[model samples]
Target: MAYWLMKSEPYEYSWSQLVADGRNVWTGVRNYQAANNLRAMQVGDRAFFYHSNEGREIVGVMEIAKTAYPDPTDETARFVAVEVTPLMAAVTPVTLAAVKADPRLVDFSLVRQSRLSVAPVRDGEWAMLCEMAGISA
Candidate 1:
């Protein structure tokens, strides 16, 4: 399955919120490229639930529960949203600092496209990050 990194500001919606809610619709993506990333996702695919802005760390894992669908929150209907369910919390959150310091992750989309809220994650990168977070890939 495809892997992805989905970012949300801690104040807006944190990993703890997802765990409490059980699941949520990942929406409000207005960027074309990020929309495309959402469109490319499928049920069962995994994603890193990253806390951007304040925390700047991957706090947990989530899995797509539904494929792309017209986002209910998008009035323009130009974007799509995927249903996601919390999978597991990181034993140790992988901070952006750690990610940046790792030379092997130089090409990681999260580093290259810092402004992108949703980004693709290569299989190897996913495994490495999971390992660093003390979780199974």
Candidate 2:
């Protein structure tokens, strides 16, 4: 299964909100690369839920509940979205600072491409991140 990291602003949609809502449609991607990442997601693929802007940390995990579909939020129909269900909250949220300091994650997309909202995670990076968050991968 492919691993991914998806970012959401805390105020817009926090990890707690996802847990409460059970699941949500991950949409509104405008960037072509990020949009492609959304389209690449398949059902059952796991993702890290990163709280961007305010917290800048990976707070939880989620599973892709549905494959990509035309985004209802986009009138142009150029974008797509996927349904994601909360898997488990991280025992310890992995901060950006911690990630930056870790040599193992030096080449990660999160570090290489800070502006990307959705980024692919390599297997080794995923394993290390799960360990950092105190979660079983």
Candidate 3:
């Protein structure tokens, strides 16, 4: 299965919110690149639930529950969204500071393309991150 990372602002939608909701449509992506990433996602692919902006950490794991579909929020009908289900919350949220400090994660998209809200995660990096979050890879 492919691995991915998706960011959401804590104030807007926190990890706790996702857990409470059980499942949700991951929409509102305006960026072209982020939209492309969303389109590329498939059902059952694992993803890191990142708390962006103030929180700035990977707070949980999620799985894509639905493939790309036309976004209802888009009046132009140009974008798409996927549905995601919560898998697990991290024992210790992996902060951006922690990621930047680790040499093993230096080349990660989270570092190289910090502005990206949706990005691909390599298998090795995914394994290491799972370890950091106190979960089995």
lDDT per residue as tens, model 1, 53-126 = 99999999999999999999999988999999999999999999999999999999999999999999999999
TM-score of each: 0.98, 0.99, 0.98
lDDT tens string, model 2, 17-105?
A: 99999999998888999999998988999999999999999999999999999999999999999999999999999999999999989
Models ranked on lDDT:
1, 2, 3
Where model 2 places Cα greater than 4 Å from the true spot, the runs are: none
Give the candidate number with the greatest lDDT. 1
- Per residue, candidate 3 scores C-alpha lDDT tens digits across 1-137 of 99999999989888899999999999889999999999988889999999999879999999999999999999999999999999999998999999999999999999999999999999999999999999766
Candidate 1's C-alpha runs over 4 A off are: none
As for candidate 2, its clashing pairs are none
Model 3, residue pairs in steric clash: none
lDDT of each: 0.96, 0.95, 0.94
